[model samples]
Target: MLSAAATPAQLSAQAASGEAGLERSERAAEEQQADNIIVTGRAQKLYRVETTASTKLPTEPLLSSQNVSVITSELIQDQGARDAQDIYRNISGVSFFSYAGVTARGFRQEEIFFDGLRGDPYAGFSVPQLFNLDRVEFLKGPSGMLYGPGAPGGLFNYVTKKPQDKPFSADVRGIVGNADRIGGSAEVNSSLGGGFAARGGLFYEDRGLFRFNAASRTLIADGGVSWSPGPVTVILQATRYDQELDASRLRGVPTDDDGNFLADRRWNHNEPGDFLNLRSDVLQARIEAEPLPGLTLDATMRYNDATEVQNYHEPRGLFDSDGDGIRDATIREFRDQRRDEESWSFGGNAVYAFDLGGDVGNRVLAGFDHFNGEEIFAGRSLRGRNRVVAGLPSPLSLLDPVYGQSDPATYNQGPFSIFNTDSRRTGFYLLNELTVGPVIITGGIRQDNFHDDSDGIVFEDEATTYRGGIVYRVTDEISLFGHYATSFEPQDPSVQNPLAGGPFAPTAGDIFEGGIKTALMGGRIQSSLSAYQIRRRNILQVDPRGDVGNDGVDDFVAFGEVTSKGIEFDLAADITPDWVLTVAYAHNDTKITGDNGGGGILNRVGDRFANAPKHQLGIWTRYQIPDIGIAAAFGGDYVSEQVSLSGQPVRPFMIFDTSLIYEVGPIRAMLRVDNLFDKTYAVSGFIDRTGHFPGEPRSIFLEVGYAF
Candidate 1:
């Protein structure tokens, strides 16, 4: 939560103290170049202005009264981030909860944006490469004002690296690592014919896990062109990604009740038959014009299409206990699912700066914006394989007959039962900012209209969101700020179709937040603290007694409330002339403020939310030596224990990472190590289950590149 300071004057004094220490550290780092400089291929700085969350006024996007984190291209390269998931790991207050491609923040969803365009984290479609990215910005808090409909946790904006004014530039890089993993990227940026510029890039990577024959491959392509004439500029871009996985199964080890089990060695029981495939395409167009002095207008249009397919199988005999001390039962089950989706969004915004008459002070930034988007998702699953047959009984009763295969026809596990679902939304917003002397105040409002149509089923609704904030410059290096904002999202429908029997409905939320930010040491150091409380309504859950194979009961439909109260702290500083450090912390209490479980186990656990970690901490530090052209970085993240559906606490785990880089003229070489300590832990998985799968183990990589 945001801490209360003594006074504005006192805050400034504290900032000064912090700044002095940082400058000294930098100087010391420069002197100890040999020890400080480790070549790591990560970005060191970022563009702070354009990456914020405010969509109404471009002027206030930099200081939008919301917590913002910027990850520059320099940091991406330095950290050797491979895909979108890697970026999420580097950022604080974010965590991937399950292999379902879902990320969580204070037990809520995490929103995603690409080049300021909407993207879905739950689609489970694509993992974009960082090769063509310029930087990534994390906007903390509900963003219903800027986005049509969104989550209350926060949003991530991935800014693409556009073509520069330079005539021509090209780069080719490659990385070689364990598990026969070799990958490379090619990027080119150039000035085309008269009044035009273009950029294009391609990337391909493959890697393996410690598990037998488990490997994955990813391919990405992105290209863009811009045409400029007079005060107008038009740009068009396209991006495509395809990721393929051979096979991966949930990890498990031998255990004897009481949760005691073995280590890295897997029990020779479960079958190795699971795989996933994903493909996505994105196309966008942008137009910008300087219609008048101190004013600029921008309009953007984008289209996205994605497809995902997965074949999941869990051996029914995974719990085998043979009289000969061997895994005998060979039962098998598989689920195949496919989802195709298409969506497009169009939006425009205008930024105007004006001055009030006389000594009343000058007011800058009057703006308005509008956006609309639509998406469709459809999928199905098949279950029921192993038949129960009475047999001998041991400490663990053995009655069910288990085999390696099941009848696909009997289980209804053939092609699929098609059920199309769609979510569409539109929004209009207006904002104004007034700056007088050392104080700046901003106010804005957004009207949102959302419609969901699933298989011709329609649900329409609308809401108006509002926000207001003020910032007082206590000193040149410190600022005091507070903000209040409201946001919402259309809840997922749970009512199954009368004929098809699939779920449909909408859930919404209300969020309130306040925070403070400070910049010191000639803008080399930045820090912020924020506190927030989010309340949600109409939370959806599955019925305990309802037919798992059919939608029969209405117990799945219920009304409930969840509240997430949390404090976040972030800091970035140039500790020494050659050293930089970034740190972040989050403490959250997310729970069901009002209970209505609809007969689910969740309600029996005192209304506690699942998969919500109470505490998270992270630190990253890098040292660069211009004299010797070397850089190095080290960091790790820690998450507190989380509770399961049975009210059992899952053990916590920590992951550490480090990298080094060396630069000689235009040529650079780097090495990186993830999970350096070979810490056995579970990054993400299901709850209420004992044997949590082990995450990626110690991995090493080497890379070489040249730039023009």
Candidate 2:
């Protein structure tokens, strides 16, 4: 949903998000300094993004020597994408891992930031809906140099929609779809005079699920105010999110290594009275100042309060008590949980631009950030034994399950854990970029000190990470780049297992990447091809030496390593003024290079990471008919076969999606069909004992909206 041109209001929004930079030329930079809003009225790719805020450097993505992808609000609305899961198919080398978790570049990635700053959007399980969002930016590979400790694969940053100077505008929409789906949303934006603007949006949905007695409901509301009274700008915003899932989280359906389910596709053991619910409230503020030409400063602060309550029934395992070689029932356990958390963070940065004589230009940036969070949890201590209710249907039947059975034993729980956790981190970072002739050099370093306390047990560590990259423009339309980066994450300290050894060491990651980027067809086409190798060390692995701890449990050791290398290609093209196309493909080969007792004959070494597909492709195109206000879009996503954690083969899948749209001055309607062919495939493989996750079936949705 990118655009070729925008008004000055849009320019201000970009600067507030830290995405405004020297994209085209020196003149653009001068104009931006003079008015703090650059004019890019010239022709540009409609679906291509030139810059991102993830790097924290005033450089464009084409010259940054890194891989970053942008999903704009336009694209999201046109494709009828509701959440991050629906949009994952459009990104390269990204796949679903678990609840709100993704497999990125051969590793599990769940880290999310808001407006380029590390903060939780909606904590635990539920993913945030794409309402009141300007865009979603993804940075591939380790970002420890700027963001701090994280998984090596990559991270996601969601940019919030900001108030803009524009005529009064309002929109309202209603949605209807299969599976008893119904929803509605409304948004309003206007200039309130006195150098002030305000925007607000609200969304609500209630949808039915395939699982019996399982349904979902979500509500989100956000409002923000922006003021630009002279050389400084300030923004304040607040958001509230509430969601509830009718049952405990599903693990997967019971299946074999070949992904053939043994039970009904909708098989579930959750009781009718079980539930999982979450509530979160956030307050955010940002300020930007341009006290002098060529020098800019910005600061951000956020405070969050959240709570979660869950009470559900869990399936222990299939029980074949009849000894007839058939697992007809499951042992059940009742669990109750309550969690309350509060978090706050502050970040500020200063950027200075100056000339080093000649045609050389340089920009130096310095930043400091701090974060603190605390959580208190009280949950059932035991999982299966003491928590297991003894009564009719407590050990639910898998074949002919009966519900509405009451178990008095579960009315009162036995043992419980009242755990309190506190975590704090502070970081200082510096970045310098130099542009000379057709060559650009970028380097950054960050030092972070983190402390964590869990029920009186404390762990503290400090780490310094580095990043360096270079981009050489071969011509005005082609460029070559190379990058190197490192990452670090401290392992939460734990008591030495009697047999698994002492507290584990921190995990480390590094990557080497090179690529070529091209913009052709007079700015109508943009493309990039890159290859990279990433290595992760000191990962935890199940101890293969047998349970030496003698505590009746499997042990783990910090002696695992993995390597991921891949090639990625992405392109966005505007064939004509009315037609647009986008394609992304990736090939990744991930292997475990080191492990604990990895196979002597048949082991974990050389095995691909779970849920990591070797090949992935996504293509989307939209064509609008001239003067008719009609547009049609067709898209497909293909993912190669992947292995599950239980060594099961998740068959490859190709899903086609189509949408028809009709738009007039103030009214619009869209009909979208997903999984057009109704392919039955597994979304992901979860556990050894459970079944693989099932993919959604064919669905059709119709939406109507009006603009005033």
Scored by CA lDDT, what does every candidate get?
0.61, 0.76
In model 2, which regions exceed 4 Å deviation?
1-46, 321-324, 381-393, 397-401, 406-410, 495-501, 541-557, 598-606
Full-model lDDT, candidate 1: 0.61
Alpha-carbon shift of residue 162 in model 1 (angstroms): 2.3
Candidate 1, residue 481: how far the Cα is off, in Å: 1.5
lDDT string for model 2 (440-505, tens) is 989999999998887877777788999999989876667789999999877754433334554566
Worst 10 residues of 1 by lDDT: 1-10
Q: Of the candidates shown, which would achieve the greatest TM-score relative to the real structure?
A: 2
Per-residue error for 18 in candidate 1, Å, reads 24
With candidate 2 superimposed using the best TM-score fit, by how many Å does residue 259's alpha carbon deviate from the native?
1.0
For all predicted structures, in order, the TM-scores are: 0.82, 0.89
lDDT of 1 by residue, 429-540 (tens): 8777777766778877888777666667766778887777777767766777777666776655425443223343445666677677766764456677777887766655
